[model samples]
Target: MNITVCNPLLRTPLSLIVDDSCPVINLTYYWIHQRHAWKARHQPNIAPERWEGDTIQLKKIPPTIPADFAWEWAEWCWENGVKGKFSLIPYPAGIGRVDEGFPDFPTREYQAWLRIYRELIWPSFDLTPEMLTHTAVVDLDTFTLTEAWEQVEWVDPPVDNRLTDYIIIAMEMLDNVGIPCEGVTSPGAFGKRQEAAYARAVLTASQHVNNNPRPFYFLWLKHDELPDVPIWYPDKEKGVAIASIVSCAGDWFGGWTGYDLGDADRFITEDLQGGCLPPILEKELPCVLVGHWPGFYFNGEKSGFEILKTVKARLDAYDPDGTKTLWMKNSEIGHYWMARELTKLTVMEEPPQIHLSTQFPTANFTLALDTPVRHIQVNGWDLREVHSRRDFQTDTFLVEGKQTFVAFDLEVGKTELELIVA
Candidate 1:
C-alpha cells in the first residue's frame, strides 16, 4: 500500500491577517504625523503632494476606534468561529505604551480597551506586536525615536542582535499588558531586505519571551500564486524553527486609511465563480487574506467589516458544509506545514504497519493509503472510521476509492500504528 501525508483533514486552509491595529488609538491619525516628521528630517521628497490628502482623510476618521467597536467585532468573530492574527502596537507611533496608557487618553477608556483585548480578541486571534512603534524607528539604546521611518530604515541593516533586541522589547511591552505573543508582525517594509536575519530575530525573540520554539511571522503579500509557509532558521538539535507565512490576497475590503471602500467581489464574487479565493481553494493551498484594522472601521461606517462578511459568505457558498475548506489561524497553518515537511514516516508491508516520528505535536494529522483498511490502532487504541468528511476528525478514518484516509492526533516524539488491511 502506498501511503502519503495529506493536508489537515485533507481540506484547504484559510486565514486572515490584520495589520496596523492597536488598542484604542486610530493608528492612521498618529501614523500620518510621524511619517510627515520623518519625511521632513530624512527623505524630503516622499510625495509632498499627498500630505494634504492624508490630512483630509485623517479628519474624517475618528481619533479612536473605541472599545465598543472592538467588543462588537470580537463577538462577530467568536460567533462565526473566525480565527486569525491581530497586531497590538506596544508604543503605537510613540503615542503611548499599552501597558502604561496613552497620554491625554482617558485612563478608564484605555483600561476598557485592554480588557476587551484580553477577554475577547485573545480567544480567537494570535496577538502580536507590530514592532515597538509603527512609525519612526526607535533607537534601542536611547529609547528615543530616530528620524528614519521604521519600514524604510529598519529593512536596510543586515541581521544583527539589535533586531532581536528590538523585537524582544515589543513582545515585553505586550507581556506587561497581560497579552502573551507567539510571534511578531512587521511594520510596512520592515526587514523585507534581509529576510534570513529577520526570521532568526523573530525565532530568538519569541523563544526568549514566550518560550515558543516553533514560531511564525507575517511579512509579504503575494497574489499571483498560492503563498507558502517557508521555514527558516531550523535547528533540529535545539528544537527551534520559524516560518514566514505570507498572505495570499490583498486588502480588498478597504485601505489602511479607513477611507477607501474596498470591493468584496475582488476576493469572491457573489456567484462564487470568480475571485482570488477560488483558485486557491481549487489548489487546496492556504488562502491567507490580508486586511487592516482601521479599514474595518471605514470611518465608523464599518463598510470594511461588511465586506469581510460578504467575502466569508461567498466562501461558504462555494464550500458549503465545510467539507473543502478549513479556517485556521496563521500559527496553526505554520505548524501544519512544519509537520508536513519535517515528520518522518516509515511503512511496513508484512502485517501492515506504519510509524511516525515528529518534533511537534499536531492535531487532525491525516494520511491517505492506497490499500483498504480493515482496522487501525494507534498505540493499541482502535480508531473509529467515519463515513462522511463532515464526520471525519481526529482518530477517525474514511475510505474512498482505492485510498483509505485516516485522521488522528499526532503527538510529539513517536507514534506507532497497526494498519490491518484486507
Candidate 2:
C-alpha cells in the first residue's frame, strides 16, 4: 500500500523578501556642546574638571580649538562615505555665573561658528537640539539660569507644561540661529511616562512650529538590551511616533578613560553584524552608532576618527562592490525607517500598476525592485531617469540581474506608479 502526505508550506510574501543589498550605517555624535568643547580644549587650565584622588576626569583633551578640527572632520566625511547627526546646544554647559541671565545666541564668535556650520557642516550632518543648555534649568519667567550641579534631570513624569515649553524654546532658538532642528537627543534618561509625555509634547509642538508633521526621532544612548532595530515610542493619545535609535557603542570619548580603538572596533562590528545587519536582512532597519565630539579628537590627533576610517575600510573590504553597505546621515536613516514602517504597497494586475500609500504621505521612501524596470511613472508622470555610476552620492543601486531601485516622495493620498518591466 502506498501513502501520500500533503505539505503545508506556501510561497514567501514579497514584503518579506525585501531587498537586503543596501545596508545603512548611521553615526550620531552626542553632546556636541561646541562652545563648551572649544573652551575645554583651548583653555584646559581654566576649564572645570572633576578632581579625584589620583586622576582628573577630563582626559585626552584636544590641543587647539575645535573649529578647524570640526571643519576638517566635516570635509573628511564629505570626501569619505560618512554622514552623521550632531547634538547641538546654544549655550555651553558653564556659560556664565549661576545668577547670570539666561544665555542667548548671536554672540559674535558663535555667530561666525554658526555661519561655518551652515555653510560647511550642515550639508554632511543633521543637527539635533541637545537642549538649550546642556546641564542647566532656565526659568522661562525670570530668564534666570541655574548652575549645572544645582539642576536635576528633566522630571520623569515631566512638569505639566515645562517639558513642552523647553522643547519649543530649544526649537525656536535653533530656528532663529538658522539651524534646522529635525530631531532631539534627551540630555538624560526618562521613564516610560516621561518618554510618553515628551513624545506627545514634541508631536504637538512640531506640528504647530514647523507646519510639517514629520516624525521626530529621539536618540537615546543607554539601553540594557542592545536594540536590534530602531524602537518606536508611540504616544497613542497624541497619535505621534518617535523612533528611538539606540547607541550600540560606548561613548568613544570615554576611551580616554581606559577604552581604546579595539573596544570601539568591537562595538562597531557588533553594531554592524549583530545589531544592524540582522534587521536589514529580515526587517530592513538601519544601524546607528553614537559617539561624542571630544571622542573623535585627542591631543591634535583624530583618535576616534581614525578608528572609524579603519572600520569603513574593513566594511569596504568585506563588501568590495559596495552593493550591500550604505553610509547615511541620521536624519536620512530615520526618514527611510519611518517611511518603511508606515508604507503599504499593493500590486494591482488589472491596470498593471503598483499602488503605494503611507500614513506619512509627505515622507520620502526608497523602493528596491526585484524585477527589471523599463519605466516608472509616479502619479501619472514619467520619472526622469539619470543613468550614472557615481559613488557615494548615487541614489540608484543595481541588484539581482539589473534590478532597479528608486527613491521617491510619497504624497498624502494614494500614489500610483506604473512600472513597465523589461
Candidate 3:
C-alpha cells in the first residue's frame, strides 16, 4: 500500500493508499500521533476520481476515516503476532488480454472502491510483516494464470527508460526530505552497444555536483529479449540454474544471453550480466523505493509481482522485535494459504568497524593495519569505508604496531565516542 519516492533516508508512514486495480481505500495505523505525514493515526489522505483521458491526476489525496471502521482490525493483526506498518490488501485479479475491459467494472465503481475503503474498510485492517519496499522476479514473458502485463509502448523497456524510473522514484524521495534533485527518464538507446554510453551519462550527471556524499541508488533493469540469467525455482529438485550474465553485474563475468527450456548448457557466454536490481545487487542501499500503482500489484506473484510485494515484504520485516504480518514473498505463498509473516527471523552481525583517520586532510595516509580482520566486506557507503585489520597487541616482539581496528568497535548510543589518531 506504500508508494515510494527516491531518497536515502528511510520512512515509515502511519498511513497509505492501496490500489487494487483502479484504486481503493487508504490504510493507516491507529493514530499514533507521531509523524506529520500521518494526520492523527486514524485519518488518511485519499485521491479524487479523475477523467479517463487525463494524463496526470491529483497525486495526493487525503485518506478518509470511516464511521463503521474500528481499531478492531489492529487487534487481529496484533494478536496474530502481526507487526509493522504494511497493509496487505488482497484483490481479485489476474492478467488478461488488453482488448478485454480492464478490472471488469464501471467507471463509477472505481469511485465506489475508494468509498468502501475510506468509509468502511481502511481503519479495520491489520499490519503485515511487509516493509515499505522489497524485491521479486516477474516472468511476464511466461504463461501464468494471471493476465499478461505487457510493457507500455512508450515504455520501450530501454536501459535509459529503466534508469529513468529508478531515478524519478529516488529523486522524489529526496525531494520529500527537502533535498533538491532533478533528472529525467530519457528514452532508451537504439541498440545494445549504446547502453554503456547511456548509463555513463545518467550517472555522471547525477554526480559532478553534490559534495556532501549524497547517496545514489542505481537500479539497472536489463531489457535484453534473450539475455542469459539465473533461474530460481521454489521447487527442491529445480535448484538455481545459470541462464546468462546480466549487464549490471559488470563485464567481469562477460555479457549475458537467453535460454531455451531444454537448453542444459551449464556455462555459456563470457559476460554474465549481473546486478540489475536497483542499487545493484549486494551493493548496500540505506533505503529502497517502490511504486504502489494498482497495475503493479494485481499483476500477482510468480507472474511479475516483485514490483509490489518483494519490496513490501523485506522492508516491512526490518525490525525483528516488531510484530508484522507474515506476507509471503510475491503473494507466491509456499504451499501455505495464509499470507506469510516476516518477523526478524534472524540477526545478522554488523560488519566490523574501520575508522579512517589521516595525519592531515591532505597528508598521504598510507599504512595497512593488515591483521586477520573478521568480515566479508560489504557496506561500501560513499561517505565512509570500513574494514577490519589486526594490529600488534603488545605481548612478544610483535612485528607490527601496538593497536588494531577491533579495539575501536562502536557501541550503540555511545555519544562522543573516542577514536585513535594516526
lDDT: which candidate is best? 1
Candidate 1 residue-wise lDDT at 381: 94
What candidate 1 gets wrong by more than 4 Å, as runs, is 41-53
Q: Kindly provide the TM-score of model 2 when superposed on the true structure, using C-alpha atoms.
A: 0.69
- Ranked by TM-score from best down, the candidates are 1, 2, 3
Error of 1 at 70 (Å): 0.9
Q: Is candidate 2 or candidate 3 better by lDDT?
A: 2
Candidate 2 lDDT over residue span 1-422, tens digit each:
11111000000001100000000100111112332454466666775342110123223332223455666766777687566666565543435221222244224434445555677666766666655555556776775664331123464635477777877776776676666566666654432346667776775556656543554544355435444335355433333455554554445432422223334445435345642334432342344555555446533566766766665565555456654456655655555555556666787765557787665543235565666677778877776554532231222322235556555566555788787766
Question: Each candidate's TM vs. the true structure?
Answer: 0.96, 0.69, 0.23
The residue-by-residue lDDT of candidate 3 on 82-158, one tens digit each, is 22112222211221121122254454534444444344433332112111111111223442322111111222334
Which residue runs of candidate 3 sit more than 4 Å off their true CA positions? 1-179, 182-192, 207-219, 222-294, 297-422
User: Which 10-residue span in candidate 2 carries the lowest summed lDDT?
Assistant: 16-25
lDDT of 3 at 159: 60
- The whole-model lDDT of each prediction reads 0.84, 0.49, 0.23
lDDT tens string, model 1, 375-397? 99998999998889988888999
Q: Once superposed on the true structure, which residue ranges of model 2 sit more than 4 Å away at CA?
A: 1-64, 94-109, 147-152, 155-159, 190-193, 222-241, 253-262, 268-284, 359-364, 368-376, 381-407, 420-422
Every model: Cα RMSD to truth: 1.7, 10.1, 20.7
Lowest summed lDDT over 10 consecutive residues: which window, candidate 1? Answer: 47-56
